[model samples]
Target: MSAHRMSDPLDRRRFLTAAALRGATVVGTGVIGATALGAVDADAVFAAPLRRPLDPAVPAGAFVEGRITSIDGGVLEVAGSHGDYARVRVTGATSVWKVRPTTAASIETGDGLYARGVPMPDGTVAADAVWVNIVNLHTTIRGIEKTRLHLAHGSHEIVGNLLPATSSASYSGAAPTADLSGLRIGQGAQVLGAWRPSDDSVDIVRVAVGPGAGHRR
Candidate 1:
């Protein structure tokens, strides 16, 4: 999930307290992993989806899908399926959440998201955001590493250890690779994914990061 009132620490705390009363858990315990720090300019990877109206009568209103390119404070930088950027505002009323059954628990970069709300003056959509739309894509593993792994579609740079049961399970038609040696650093990969915000790391079900991973989903 996300801390919506991210602009001010004090405001975040107060807002979170209110959210807790509303039955939303606001602890920075689990859900978000990574710092949202690194530059994500990899625009060539995603393919644009065909546009179908959410409701023809609604004209300017429809659901758009995209990969989360970056998150700075309360701002969510989403590069759309068509390679367009949708800068969304994560306000106190905004929700931070996830999709289910992808993993035990893990959140990482590259998750899919959908937001709903009004568009703002700066070209950013003001999300009356729903956090549950975020999805953890599942893929098979083709490589491994000491810290990071070469997944099947995108790189899963893990920040912690992988369990034997989790690592050994077959996903996307392949079992987990045992050794980390000889894996390329910049190749793309895919894997069964999960997000555990408490640990600040994502768990991989499988990975396919390598030279042959250009197959798009």
Candidate 2:
């Protein structure tokens, strides 16, 4: 069976149930961050706020953000962060990454998402890429060890794990290097990583140190 079809049916069902409940609550309560976009302009919407502009060769599309409301087959229904609703069509060509290359089966309801895709005439988005539950956090290092860094993000404590062969650190915003020995306790850092669905832990993709640590794209 294809990996996409490998998600446990029971898990999907449970996720769908929870998603429905959450969607209703979100709608009724009128959450603070939810806003509706009457019309979407993909290129303008998906552009990363802090990152460098994407290549001009890329086609324009709507950028959608919010919690997953439902997933039926390959269509993902999302309640936009600003109160808009969007249907994102995911195909085999779509690149799904969350700190690393991943499959569509890994997606679950209630998870946050950022998707970039061409907007269809029908108002749906033909997604070319999706980043699920990715977080860029600016925090201070509370403690450090050989393989993990204890961080303070507001009032919450975050545990960041350095993934061997994949994790690296950057001084300023220069090229990333594998050496993390320069990282120190009580230092300010910015972490770009994927949040674990089960806990406050994050699997680090890259760590930035120094005054401009967390501001880089």
Top TM-score model: 2
What TM-scores do the predictions have?
A: 0.33, 0.65
Q: How many residue pairs of model 1 clash at the backbone?
A: 33
List the RMSD of every prediction in angstroms.
14.0, 14.0
Deviation from native of the Cα of residue 82 in model 2, angstroms? 3.6
lDDT (0 to 1) per candidate: 0.43, 0.67
Instruction: For residues 1-217, write the lDDT of model 1, one tens digit per residue.
Output: 1333233223322332243234333223333211123221212101212122333332233244676677655556778888787865554434444533221133234656676644444566644333433334534344456655534434443442354544433323454565334335454344444555456455544444444645543
Model 2 residue 98 distance off true place after TM-score fit, in angstroms: 1.0
Model 2 residue runs over 4 Å out of place are 1-60, 211-217
lDDT at position 117, candidate 2: 65
- Residues 182-204, candidate 2: write the lDDT tens digits: 88888889999988867769889
Q: Which ten residues in a row have the lowest lDDT in candidate 1?
A: 40-49
